[model samples]
Target: MRIAVTGREGQVARSLLATAPSGIEVITIGRPELDLANPASVLPALAAAQPDVIVSAAAYTAVDKAESEPESAFAVNAAGAGAVSEAAAKLGIPVIHLSTDYVFSGEKLAPYVETDPTGPISVYGSTKLEGELRVAAGNTDHVILRTAWVYSPFGANFVKTMLRLAETRDELRVVADQRGCPTSALDIADAILAIAARLKADPDPALRGTFHLTGTGEATWADFATEIFAQSRALGGNSATVTPITTAEYPTPARRPANSRLSGDKLAATYGIRLPGWKSSTEIAVKAILKNAI
Candidate 1:
């Protein structure tokens, strides 16, 4: 089957390409070929690819900076998604769009389900939520997979940031108040492909809805950092003492959700797919980073 991936050079896209799924032709479109900020780029790109399935991994993910650039965020996340969905609809193809857990207000202590009402606290969250709505509305065959705290070997992410910061600084502080599953982009890419492959086999209208996909475990930023550094030391990498701090201690332009944990029970029961624990996924990412560094 032919599958076209947006944000082709992104961390997730790169992983999907590296771990290219079996019996599938992967077409990657990035930056100059298709920019999410430019809505006009989406349809033409989709038409050019003429893919059986379109996986939109492209997004304006500058969380903190999004607060000041809400217009650009909305344009890319919302309008851009709408364009892709509309184009897919024309081609009678199914679309898989990546979303975020930030769409929620972060009030629940437990894992978030797909049915929960969203109340975004940040501009980035609001924009992504808008994108989800537009995609859902524009296409009959659409799947919005909302994941959180995504980290990978391919791009700039929290894990890389912590690792880089820990190198020069002996002591590091990370926010402890917020919690979420640190999903690996490679895992997410696998999940997306599994769903896409299934959809290709049997096009079901019932499968068209928003679903949450994440790692099995959860942790705060501080806890996650501690594990990262601990693993780094075990791997013979640099070691740094990571201190815990509240979200108030380190403020950003965008407000982060306190609870970004998402439930994958639905994904398992429906798709018959299970994701690995954060530790295992993080280990893979660490190894990849180390290999690249060497």
Candidate 2:
């Protein structure tokens, strides 16, 4: 089936391009030719591509900057998403959109379920939640996948940040109070492909809805950083020490969720896809990064 992937240059999109499944006929559209903010460009691009499925992976993800640039964030995340969803609806095609766990306020003690109430604390989260609302409103045949703490071998993420800092610093401080799972972009892409194939084969509009996608285990930012350093040391990269700190110690413009864990049970039950443990995926990612550095 033909699939058009937006935000072709992003880390997750790059990973998707690098490891996309065979026989999928993937077409990528980046900026200049297909700007997400301009709703006028969306339908025309969709018409030209004539894709059976559109993957809206493009997003304005500057969490901290979003506090001051709410308009820009909403323009891309909400308005842009609405455009794509509208186009897909017009053409009788399905859309698979990416979302975030930031939609939750993180006040809950347990992992967030699909049906849980959304209460975003930051501007980024609020805009993303708005985007999901618009996309779902525009089309019924759409899949909104919410993932968190995503890291990848190809993009700018926390894993890479830790690796870089480990090279120069003897010790690094990471927020231990904030908790979530570190999901790999490769795993997310694979899951997206599975959902796309299933949708292609089944074409069930009712199967489309919001679902949480994350790694198996839960961890804090400090826990994740410590694991990264440990893995990097195992791979003979760097052995920098990581010190745990509270979120209050490192304040940013955007307020992050202290507990961002998401439940993948619904996704597993419906899609029959199991996400691998974060540590296993991190091992593979760290090895790749180290090898590339050599």
Give the candidate number with the greatest TM-score.
2
What CA RMSD would candidate 1 show? 1.1
Model 2's TM-score against the true structure: 0.98
Off by over 4 Å in 2: none
Candidate 1 residue pairs that clash: none
What are the lDDT figures for the candidates, one per model? Answer: 0.88, 0.89
Clashes of 2: 0
lDDT score for residue 267 of model 2:
88
RMSD of each: 1.1, 1.0
Supply the global lDDT for candidate 1: 0.88
TM-scores, all candidates, are: 0.97, 0.98
Those runs of model 1 whose alpha carbons end farther than 4 Å from true positions after fitting are none
Judged by lDDT against the true structure, how good is candidate 2?
0.89
